[model samples]
Target: MATHLITGAGSGIGAIVAERLAERGDELWLLARSAKRAAELRERFPAAHTLVGDLADPGKLSWAFGHQSLPVELDSLVHVAGVVELGPVGETPVKVWQETLAVNVVAPAELTRLLLPQLRLARGHVVFVNSGAGLTAHAEWGSYAASKFGVRALADALRAEEHAAGVRVTSVYPGRTATPMQRKVHQQEGVAYDPERWIAPESVATAILTAIDLPRDAEITEITVRPGR
Candidate 1:
């Protein structure tokens, strides 16, 4: 079984993906921002390993990538950690904008750069959990949209650069999934997007696993899964 490392593994899509990876007998290194959440994940997947680090911090990201305690290489990396900050362009604070960009774009890019050697060793895959916002613009989501667009571009470039090295980069655009982040968005906007109608977390997790398990010759470049309605 291949070894997988997932960031934002504390909750939402990240947590769900970790659970599924562990269920499938894949060894996992879960990175969470919170110690409590890391402990919770450890409890949920007793067989899986855990790492606690905040990707938003440059030092933490460096520590996570450079630490010798963990394996120097991984067979796959599922980048599910990102931020969504909603506000009109003028109203958004500089700090909020930085945080969003850091988590959604800069952090992932830096992590990828630092971990490139490790991935190259394993000739592994990179899974980016993107958003529909990355594909289209929406109101008051400028920061988030910009970050995701950068993410998409990064994924595309990585795929092109690593195709010859047997590294597969898959970008998954999941629209309106049921997660705490979505719920927060709904509360702020006063729009109750139906959970049942939305794409379930497990469904998206399945798509991720499928991409990881695919034969090296076949590549699922991009998958956009949304609510049926």
Candidate 2:
């Protein structure tokens, strides 16, 4: 079975992706911020290795990965952890911008750097769970859009740099999804939460799985999933 590491596996798209991988009998390493949620995942998927720590903290992330006795080879790494703080550029808090970039861009970049050796050994695939905001910036989504744009840049650069190394990089830009974070966004916008109006997290997970399942000769460099209006 292929070994995969997934970030933000405690909930939302990450959790659904983790479940799909587990169903395929892949060995999984799950990184989650919540200890309670990590414990629950451990119970549900007893074979998974759950790491609890904040992705924004480089030191904590390093410590967690360093302590784990993972194999020298990894088949896949899926980055799904992110934070959204919506506001006009003038009104947005500096701290929110910092946190958003840290989690959405910096953390994934650092983790990928750390795992490069392992990935190269396996000629692994790296998937970045980006967003539609990465493509277009909305009025109140400057900070989030900026971070996602960084994600797109990172994936593009990585794909180009690692092509010779046989490491595939894909960025999946999913539109607004039915997730807890979406609910919060809806609340912030004073709109009712209608799941039907959003894309399902599982659908995104399926797209990711398709990328992972592709032959080594072919690479799905980027995928954009939009809600069917």
TM-score of each: 0.93, 0.95
Write candidate 2's Cα lDDT for 21-121 as tens digits.
89989999887676787888799779998777677775567777676666579999999989898889999998999899999998999889988999999
Each candidate: how many clashes?
0, 0
Off by over 4 Å in 2: 34-37
Best-fitting candidate, measured by lDDT?
A: 2
Residue 38 of candidate 1: its Cα lDDT? 80
Check candidate 1 and list the clashing pairs: none
All candidates: CA RMSD (Å): 1.6, 1.3
* lDDT (tens digit, per residue) of candidate 1 on 1-229: 8788898777788888887777778888887676787888788778878776677874577765455356567889999988787989989999988899888988888878777877889999899999999999888999999999999999999999998888899999999998888888888787876677677888888889889889887999999998877
Model 1 TM-score relative to the real fold: 0.93
How big is the positional error of residue 122 in model 2, measured in Å on the Cα after superposition? 0.7
